[model samples]
Target: MLAVTILGNNSAVPAFDRHPTSQVVTHDGVNYLVDCGEGTQIQMINYKIRRGKISHIFISHLHGDHYFGLVGLLNSFGLLGHQQELHVYAPSPLQEIIEMQLRVADTRLCYQLHFHTISGEALLVDNEKIEIRCFPTQHRIECYGFTFREKRKPRKLILDSVKQNNVPLHFYDNLKDGEDFITSAGEVIRNEWVTTAAPKGKSYAFCADTRYFEPIIDHIRDTDMIYHETTYLDNLRERAFERFHSTSKQAALIAKKANVKRLLIGHFSSKYDTLEEFEKEARDVFPNTDLALEGVTYRI
Candidate 1:
């Protein structure tokens, strides 16, 4: 099962009811923390998220609202006696900042910490079941978004077809790979007679913090679920543009254009006390849009 849990949803500052940006994506048995804002560890605890299960942490940009909790989370991981290897993916200067923090504290982590800086347009991380690709997003500073796609297995060979046709067991592998089998008598066994294509897997996209840019539609096209930042309402459109952020209506447009199944919008500006307006604005444009409430879990 693939799911995303919202740890914090507020944009810049933590309010009494809302928090800064942070989320945890759970795919298979692995967990990935995206955009560790301030008080994220406490947020994780409040949400009952298993911090030790997170193997990777992804930072969208250097904005404090998006990454201020990183150092604290890392330090807490060490303090918790976490021994598994941890990987961090972020922009260039993040490594320097983390290293500086470690240096000042004179602390060494218990696990192997790996840092990979994203410089180019796309960075791919392939595993046995899931593949993640990071793409550039238009923001004030160098920023990026991530696409997580689950890979499908090869098609299954039809056992009844093989038995009825007297095909040998050794040729099953070829049939599963969509290849025709050749017999000793030079008979060609059609792939359609023995195999069927695998079912298409699902994908999730996180379009962190960015302005309304049409180019991103291609990268997030037809995603099963997309989490985009809606930091302002339609009335604040000018302010959103001035701050290099997106309004709820603009984010809904991207989700609508990309044809995503569901749009989860968060990173709301702290100025708004009630999020009902944001939800109404987005749902007006895209009916499937929903507010990304803190502590809520969304299944993809």
Candidate 2:
């Protein structure tokens, strides 16, 4: 399963119980932390997320609101006696920042911390289970958006037909790989006759803080779902551009242009406590938009 759990949604400062920008993307039992904002670990604990399952983290930028909780979370991992290597993908300067804090306190982690600097559009992870890639976003400083794509799943077996035909259990793996099964009596059973095609792989895109930009459409086009920041209302479009932030309508336009299956909008400015208007403004343009509520899990 490919899903994203929102931990914090508010931008800059915490308000209305919203902390900062943090999310957990889970696929096939592995969790990827997208942005480590302040109080991230606490949010994860409150949400019943297994911190031990997180082996990779992707920070969109070095802004404090975006990544202030990273060092604390890493330290907590060490305290928890987690021995697996931790991989963090972010800007190159983040390595120095993390190292300085570790140095000052004379801290030593039980596991290795590998920092992979994202430069422009780069593929971060590619394995049998999942694929992750990053693309540059139009923020004030260098920032990036990440896309997670699940690998194709195995073909499903026809239980009744397989049982009736006496197909051996050991051949199940072969059948899932689309190989024809041969019975002991020399009768060949076609793979499709007893197995269904694999399910379509799901994909999710996380677009971090950015101004109204068009190039982003290419990076997140046609995704199963996308999380885009809508930091302000349409009336403040001028202010949003000055601050390198996006308005609700602007984010919706991107979702509409990209033809995504669904859109999630969050990162609200602390100026407004009530988020009903944000949803109304986005849905007006893109009907499939949803508010990114804290602690909610959005399945990709």
Candidate 3:
């Protein structure tokens, strides 16, 4: 299963009981953190997320709201005796920034931490279960967005059919791999006759802070779901453009253009005390749009 749990949904500052920016994308029991903003660890604890399962972290930018809580979390992992190696992917200057913080504090992590500097479009992780890639986004400073695509599962065996064919248990793995079985007499037992196709894999995209840019439509096209930032209401279109941020309507338009199954709108500006208007505006354009509320898990 593929899902995203929102840990923080606010932007720039924490206000009205909302946090900055952070989320956990979980697949097959593994957790991948996206953007560790201030109060992220607290939010994780509040939501009961398993911190030890997180092996990778993807940071979009160096904005304080996006990464202020990273060092603290890393420190806590050491104190807790986390043994698994941790991997962090982000743009440059972040590695330098984080190293400085650790150095000044004279901190040493118990687990190995690997830093992968993101530049342009790059494949960050490709394993048996999932494939993760990063793409550049238009922002005030260098930033990137990530796409997580789960790998297709193996076909399922038809137990009764296999038994009727007298197929041995030793060949069950091959049957699941879609391979045909043959008898000593050369009688072929077609794979499809005893197995069913697996379900299609799911995909999700995380569009970091950006303006109303259409180029991203190509990267996120036809995704199962996407989390796009809507830092302002549609009424503040001009101001949003001036500040390199997107309005609610703009995010909806992108989701509509990309033909995504669902659109999650968050990264809300602190100026708005209420969020109903943002949801209303985005849904006006894309009916499937939903607010990315904290502590909520949206399954893909």
Candidate 4:
């Protein structure tokens, strides 16, 4: 199963009821931490998220609200005696900050730490079952949005067809790979006779932090689920643009244009007391929109 759990959803500041940016994406058994804002570790504990399952972290930008908790989380990992390697993907400047913190504390991690710097749009990470790609977003400080796509498997071969045709077992792999089979008797067997194409897999897009930008539509088109930042309602649209952020309406418009099945919006401004307006504004543009709540899990 592929899902995402919101740890923090507030923008810029942490209020008593809301927090900054943070979420946990779980695909299969692996957990990925996206944007570790302050108090994220506590949020993880509060939500009963298994810290040991997190194998990777993705930071969208250099904003304090996006990655202030990263050092603390890394320190906690060491204190907890985690031995698995952890991979972090972020801008190049983050490496220095993390290294300085580790130096000042004279602490050494028990596991290997791998850092990958994202310098431009479209960074790809391929695993066995999942593929994650990062694209540039129109934020003030070099922000990025990520898309997670499940790899589509090749079609299954029909063993009954192979047997009925007396086809060689070794050629079964070829059929699954969509290749026509040539029998020993010089007869060509069509791939459709033995196999059918697999169904398309699901995809999730995370528009971490951004203003209303048209180029993002192409990157997130046809996603199964999309998480976009809606830091304010339509009334606060001017403030959102001044701060290089997005309003609820803008996020929904992106989802609508991208043809995403569902939209999850959060990163609300601290000034708002209730999220009812945010939901109303977004749903007006895209009916399939939902307000992202902390500790709530969303299936992609």
Candidate 5:
């Protein structure tokens, strides 16, 4: 159930029916929002994203395109009577910015709102079901990328083996935890003999606005999938580098170098009227690349 729904994928400006940078990473019914660009609320409504399920929001940078819709969304949450405690993680100065906006409007939220200032690479959230961490990205301003990893599942029990071994019901839990079982007579049964290892947890990384930075490969290596910004086509490599952005080929190169299972490229520049060439160019280098189309849900 680990997936990300793209709300707005365009970069800087919204054009050609595309919005700004925003998305929702959904895992096991809980939603973690990443970036709140302009028109984020409208895009969420268009995509049918359950705003109530979002308990945490991660803003990558201070750029207007990345956070212009944040205060509005927060205000809407109050108006909508959202009851869950809300947590926001971002770099410095965002708390000050949000407070000023809230103060000017004199809007009092009904629910508890928490803001966490991200300092360098650190673990943001680690609960029973998921672990989320942030790493720095090479953006024009201070920016960060986020990694969402599902917690490793418990080992599955072999019903026949447990029944044949006469293992007590109370010992089942221990077996699932990969613990060896001992009988009253001091007979030891290996955990592997009664249970199979659970599947490895799925993982996804949101590589917020960045250039062709190789250091990023270290943090995103071997992820199930990653959404990297391809702000320009291959021919505009120079322009992308100058703008602190990445081209389609560059994004694909990152995915290939990181050994990710799949790559989702978005954050397209407004100059491009069509995206077919972007996908084709990226796929040339990384066959598993796909366009991060708005309103599309990509399962990791």
Candidate 6:
């Protein structure tokens, strides 16, 4: 599993019972916070997300709605006696901003907080299980989008075949790793005869806080799912362009052009009391589009 849970979906201000921008991307039992907007902690608690499990956080920009809750969340982590080291990736200015806030409060977290500045296209994280890369997005200020790709899993063991081959239980792990089994009779049991190919890993992209950026299509191309911002309805295309924001149709167009498996639109403007029109317009172009409602989990 690869999945994303929407914590806050509104833009600028929280309104119409919606929150600001924040979300959690979960992969292989690890959680990656995409943004920490206002009230993000509250949303996490309400959704039963374990804050302690979050080892990394990615902030797209310095916009208040994008990261206002980060300080509070870190404070709460310290108060909660969290001892795990946490890594945060964002623009360089954010390090100074956070340090200033912590300094003013004379606050020091119990856990070590590492900050990695994102300036352009960069590989933020790479491990045996996952790869995370960031790319710049067109915005009024510095901003970035992220792509999460899961490494392929090991081969799956067929219980009956393994048992038939007289493979010992202790060697099950080796079989899963595609190693041939050596039986007590000194017979070589082929790995493929007892194991099957693993399922293909999934990929997800988060196109955070951008205008109608055409260049972004290359970064998000052929992803299993995409989370794009739709701060306004299609009718307000000009206004959206002027404000360096995106309309639902524009988001859909990007998804369509990128050939993503699915598109999720959110970061709705507080001006719109109803969201049905936003969903309708995006789906008009990309039929697989869905609204990124708060607390909802969309699997990739």
Candidate 3, residues 87-160, lDDT tens digits: the string is 99998888888889999999989999999999999999999899999998888999899999999899999999
How far in Å is the alpha carbon of 281 misplaced in model 1? 1.2
Better of 1 and 3 by lDDT: 3
lDDT of 2 by residue, 110-180 (tens): 99999999989999999988899999899999999999988888999999888888889999999998999
The Cα local distance difference test for each model comes to: 0.90, 0.94, 0.95, 0.91, 0.94, 0.94
Collision pairs in model 3: none
lDDT of 6 by residue, 1-300 (tens): 999999999999999989999999999889999999999999999999999999999999999999999999999999999889999999999999999999999998899999999988999999989999999998899999999999889999999999888898999889988899887788999999999989888999999999999999999999999999999998898998988899999999999999999999999999989999999999999999999999999999
The per-prediction tally of clashing pairs is 0, 0, 0, 0, 0, 0
Badly placed stretches (over 4 Å) of model 6 are: 158-194
Per-residue error for 253 in candidate 2, Å, reads 1.1
Give the per-residue Cα lDDT of candidate 5 at 268. 96
Measured with C-alpha atoms, the lDDT of residue 55 in candidate 5 is: 99
Clash count for candidate 5 is 0
User: Which residue ranges in model 4 land beyond 4 Å of their true spot?
Assistant: none
- TM-score of candidate 3 relative to the true fold: 0.96
Comparing candidate 1 with candidate 6, which one achieves the higher lDDT?
6
In model 6, what is the error at residue 142, expressed in angstroms?
0.9
Off by over 4 Å in 1: 166-174
Q: Cα deviation in Å at residue 230, candidate 6?
A: 0.7
RMSD of each: 1.7, 2.3, 1.4, 1.5, 0.8, 2.7
Q: What TM-score do all the candidates reach, one by one? A: 0.94, 0.91, 0.96, 0.95, 0.98, 0.90
Residue 41 of model 3, lDDT score: 90
